[model samples]
Target chain A: MSAAGGLPRTGSALAIWPALRRSGLGPGLLMLAVVTGLNIALQPDFFSGASLSGNIATFAPTILICVAQAVIVLSRELDLSLGAGVSLINCVMASLPQDKVGGPLGVMAIAILVAILLGAVNGLLVAYAGLPSLVATFATGAIWFGLALTIMPQPGGVISDAIGDRYAGTLMGIPVPLLIIAVAMTGWAILARHRSGRRIMAVGSNPQAARDAGIPLRRTKLLAYLVAWILVALGAIAISAQTLSGDPRLGTSYTLASVAAVVIGGISLGGGRGTPWGALVGALVLGLVTNVIYFAGIASSWQEFVKGLVIVAALGFMVLEGQRRA
Target chain B: MAFTRRGFTSAGLGLASVAALGGIKPSQAAAPVTIGLSNGYFGTEWRDQMIDASKTQFAMYENQGLAHKLIVQQAGPDTAAQIQDVRNMIRSRVNVLMIDANSATALTGVIHEAKRAGIPVIAFDQAVTDPYAINVGIDEYDWGKHYAEWIVAQLKGQGRVAVMDGVPGHPAAVARRTAFMDVFAKNPGIKIVWSGYGMWDQAKAQAVMATVLAATPHIDAVCTEDGMGLGIMRAFQAAGRPVPIMTGEAQKSFLLAWKKERDAGHDVHLFARSNPPEIGRTAVGVAVRIAAGRKLKPLPDNTYHYPIKVEVTNDNLDQLLASVADKPDGYFLGEYLSESELDKLFV
Candidate 1:
């Protein structure tokens, strides 16, 4: 790396901005813009205040889960258990007796605490026990799902109509979920600016160099997972507010969804470079795709097929965009 | 075919909520009030029809000085979210809440909360068992018993029978299954070889039927209390097995398939009954009335059992449902919502 006008320059003019072209987040943002714009065009009324607000509201949960996946990936790790983490939270929160269910703060604390504990188990298995993160989290995810099944076999509990209404409601003229996401992203950007965070990124980009540089590899790996778990827990909270109920199967589809979102955003499956905005944009793309397909009046059966096609196109775009610069 | 069983009403209606809780006294001088409604499941057409009838009935009430707003939902079939929606409605202080519960027990607490919030609740399709939640749906036990009786009749009083049940432990499934077995106690000629749990998935039921056919050599008849289980016929068709006699209620498609099977010399009968959506909407109406301060009785029979009108074959299914679907105004708290009934001023 060499500095040109205080900015790193390399390769060709394209390589001069290689970070922009190589950056996974850029294509992901493009996908988001396409999906959102297409949605607006497809259903003129889809841009109505309530509908647009709902778009933002629904995106929060999926974005959170994707970001969680992104963080884990950035640490040369994966946590397939995130969707299961969300499912577990749903069962736990809904199982709370309606009368006995405490306030939002209490329920949120317990949900996050349980999720972190589950995450720690994943960390211990992968970082200390030397099991691969993929297999470890996959197994733990199954166990978590089983636990959710045992906790609330059927949906119940009255999520404080108040909390859901408050958080899901628009503030002034914007969907509150969007506001929350903005706040979360800024905080994440600040964290990414720190030295430890840079080390995590370096560790993701090149594990050998990170090790040679004497990074506390296992601890860094463990913290990445913890952060991921926290995001998964937050995703469940957003979903809970949206649905106002805890459905065991509610989080079932989100596992593949989060992975799809991150990958679509140009995040590498092999683990390395990615960004928070990439995950957010990826989720918005998928969500908009769903809305568009349904608005197109396609049958329910077609939904799966259409989404599958979108994922393929997204991957191709990401790879092409990456190679054109390379 | 005449449909001349003039829709009439008896005085024994829900007197528990409105009259007792409502502070206002009815002097019979007000316009009908409009009530907003929302529900789930679009795959169920009978439910849609039932809702249509409920709206007609509600309109008739408005003609007689009462009204309603219908808004059903399809939220990915997520029940907890639906419950949360209802909770929000209660907080918004809807006069009364009527629900065709997805979970028999799970909704009990929400029903109770609505009641505590000064909104009466009516559990129409599925009972909640909450003391405050009044039950108004079919007598699922009787529903099961009737299905068994029909199956026995199809077998000419005896055969090897099996149950393709709904979701395990579902209130309807339990009631229908238990009533069927209880009814079978008297018909010694019928032997139940296996009870397959299909979870109300059509494809799953078809598969279950295939598995049952493979294992049970003497299975002569198959019965399911839910309309979705008729997939057994499709299962039998696919496997080319001797189609066992099949039965269920209120699905036109099933009845059409049943008629096809019967016409082609297969043994399948339709225990033609109605979906619970009507009961669901009516439960809401009753709750609203309670909140409005009208007097009501402790719902007739403690649990209102919609009549068991069996449409023996295709012709009968059409005939039965036509009467159900084309009523001037569907069955209301007391009678058919007639034009005169429909003529009452707006609420």
Candidate 2:
């Protein structure tokens, strides 16, 4: 899969492929193909308008979280608190005084600001206090959760119509959210080639070495977390947009699931290597796998079990591919 | 690394063990039939309402809903924790066990556990697969069917309808939608332009409705499961169109909406408090009864299913709220339940 690019690709065209294969994307793709075929054979309306839209709409938040998680893992840090951040943002966004968030514009801005602030806190603790990202974020995440539950004991509020109206529809038969993700990917792909981007990779690969090279290690780590949190915030908004209300508990699934997806997408847990694209691909695959399983008329209860299997398969495949390359 | 895992395991086990230790609350000398009441969590006002209702009925003692000793526990939406809680309840040898099973299927073991002890397990809000649980729960099909029935009847069964669904794949959502769709299916005039699960939240209701409005503007009315009915109305209002909206769960929010809308002279109809405090009262009753060696007949086996009364117009809304407030005990009690019904329910 990596061989298409030339030498300027700077590594074995198969450099990324090894991980993709390891991540089980190849196998995942194969299985998905099989599943798709079987599902189509079983149900003709599986690709119908309402069904497809519903699937995409249901999963947009999860996908965005995956992308945010990809960034965090690539920096060789884990934001165990991603879910907490998202949940808090969801609550805050939902609780925005109705008069204030009068439209999508106000809501989006506040949501983005909250994400950045959350990201900054994570970045500051890990970078400045020198706290282990795990402990710091985990503790903060707990606090975040406590706060969320405190705000709205139950689900409340309504998202204004502006969000649901503007972005929910399909453009040329593609979901507007997916289009937004595509644009996000395009911008990220460009950044992936820059020197600072390489620095992020270097820091992920070996922060000590990056520091020796005069790279701004703390700043980079901060940036990465901030970036991740920012995305989380955006993801929260997307979710908020989808729900049109802020559910205090809405982001719980994303907290653990995003990390799982990032690792499954072939991002190293030890950091130093991976791509936003990898996370994006991984998210899509997970989404597809989930949707396919659901639409295939399987008992809906198997979702969690299937999700666990998907994670195991991705981790297993990645290890095998890494070994094969070595 | 291993220590972290071991630590987590131990910490989790400790909370469980401590919870299982039981007898934290005061119990009577007659060993007030040891009772176990498993709640979902203490986070929401709904759960708070249940707790409040339980305490009130317990204090009243008319129906014996209380235990020689009552052990109230929260699973917080965790099926595993709830399962463990049920096990703990059994291990402690509670007389009668009343549980609101986290997930209906997962409670079979706990239900069986209660049964093997000769303890009758009564389920409220949901039925147990164990078949022993007297299910004192609202029928989801009826819950949804009634809401839909109300909307259809109000619209003369001919208006355009947009629906906001509850959490996807929830039995409640499915039953609600299914029964509703069955009714609406009868009337071809009601065009459902937008229908999707809101996952039972205010935001989702708003967003889903917003999208629906975007897709099919100027629709006649909107219907959704409670959780965010007002949220849905708010979304519709924000969009500069206030459609006749129908939903249930007239808890604090809906009650408040009832008051506001009544003052405004705009009819805001809510199908009564769907998560009635009465259900909580019944659940406690069943739990205490089994603990006291009383018969668990009629409550668990037969579903006390009824169409929730719908309150429309400000006057009716005020009247409903007033009645619920004025005669909290008898007025809220499920139809035909006796004073002794609250006997075992008290501790």
Candidate 3:
């Protein structure tokens, strides 16, 4: 998948297969394929319009969050605050008066701006203030959550039906959620092509070396956070569209889920060695695992245990593949 | 794909045969229905009891051949995951869907999808705002009002009362809080000293109550929702302060604690109402009847209010304790209506 990002193509399919297998995305792709097959086998109506759209919409927020987390992870920084940031942004968007400045569109713009500001705060704390990303984001995550609670103490704010309808609806025969995923991927592709993106990877892979080589470590890290949070903002918007409402606690699950997705995608936890596409596949795999469990008629008492087992097994598989390659 | 087609045809034929079998029984006009229950937030003992009661009710129906299956999908506090759960149930072609929703409004879209697919949704516990879904739960406002009125009466409408609420922004908690505030507002002499969220957990309630106890002086009584009364009493006990008059819930731990307090001559006055986990059982009964082509009487705002059945006070604490003697400390006291009692709601 990373090879698709403007890497010169080897003419032969056989050449591409080994190259794909050698990349960090290999294990995630394998898991995704297996889960997709399992899901299709379990539910024959998986491609029916209602089922397809519902599945895509449900998977989209997680996918976007994974991509967002991937960007931060790629820069050797982790933002635990992304989920809380999403919650705060969702609350802000929903709480905005529909009759006010430019209505839903304006609210959306403001939400994006809020996301960037939140990213900048995390970035500033981690990069400029020299605080560890984990500690900084963890503290900021609490503050964001508190602010979200203050904005909407309980979950009851209305978003426009237009957003939800379009989100759940297809445009020109393509599902809106699929389009959202496409847009995020395209955005990542563009970012990957830019110099700042290379600097981020450099900083992640070897910060001291990158600094000695004249790269601005702090700026690169901050840029990665900004880019990542824009994706987070998009994810929050997607969530608002799905729920058609705001919830202060809505993004609670995504925090840890995104990190898990990053790991499942075979992304290196310590630094850069993965693609956002890998994260997308990883998110889908996780979502489909739940689907598979439900369709398999697993007892409710065993669902959580089974889900954990599957994830652990997938991670173990990735680790084994990595070791085999080494 | 061919195998799937053959399997689908056989499944259809099996259902047809079941319908043919049901046709012989005049009382069972409709075929047995498969009920799907989607529960969000299964962290509490109350939810476990709810699911257990639901399964027991489902078994009763299955025994009478009124229900074919009960498919339950339970998960934590993720609305998106719960939506997926509902979708899975819909795809599996469950005749009806019962939900204890994570959010009041977040589920509207999927609920609408379920409606479009000809699936009726019955929301219990935390009801969704969607009009298409039938809400079957206790009147949360009344529950709160009952507790508040008791507190006001015991305090003679005058005292510093510290209020401990359940999850902040939770629908039921919000409604109950409104009731508490409204009841307290009517009596100006009753001053609310401190109010904070306990998040509907015993430990959290205890922790928050400890903070309130340390920060404030002379809290005449504590008004709190269910699942937290024992924790509140524990906080007071840990502080070595007298357990003041307080509102409690119909859980075994609290009742046992209250009994212990009375036995110790602590002069504890209490009022507790059952937020019965058996509401899920009631909802199961309703869903089965609805699936069997029972016509429901026209409901206002599409909500069927399950009557609150039990309340414990100083007068009846011992009796309730004796009844639940074999139950565990985490046991919640609850009851569901009989089939005959449920029949009154339908035409």
lDDT of 3: 0.84
Please give, for residues A27-124, the per-residue lDDT of candidate 1 as tens digits. Answer: 66767788777777877767566566656665788888898888888888888888778978977876675445467777777888988898889988
Tens digit per residue, CA lDDT, model 1, B1-347: 11111101112123322333332223343333334343544445545665665666566555544444433333334444344445445544455566665655444435545545556565666676555655666678887777788888888877989877887545577778888888888889988899868877677887887887788777777778665556787777787776666675455556556566667775444454554455544554554454444543334434544443343455565554455453432222222223322122112
TM-score of each: 0.64, 0.50, 0.91
Lowest summed-lDDT stretch of 10 residues in model 2 chain A?
A1-10
Report the C-alpha displacement of residue B302, candidate 1, in angstroms.
16
Whole-model Cα lDDT of every candidate shown, in order? 0.65, 0.64, 0.84
Tell me the TM-score that candidate 1 gets on chain A alone: 0.89
Cα lDDT of model 1 overall? 0.65
Off by over 4 Å in 3: A1-17, A317-326, B1-31, B214-217
- Model 1: lDDT of residue B199: 74
Off by over 4 Å in 2: A1-43, A171-174, B1-347
Q: Which fraction of the native contacts appears in each prediction?
A: 0.06, 0.00, 0.73
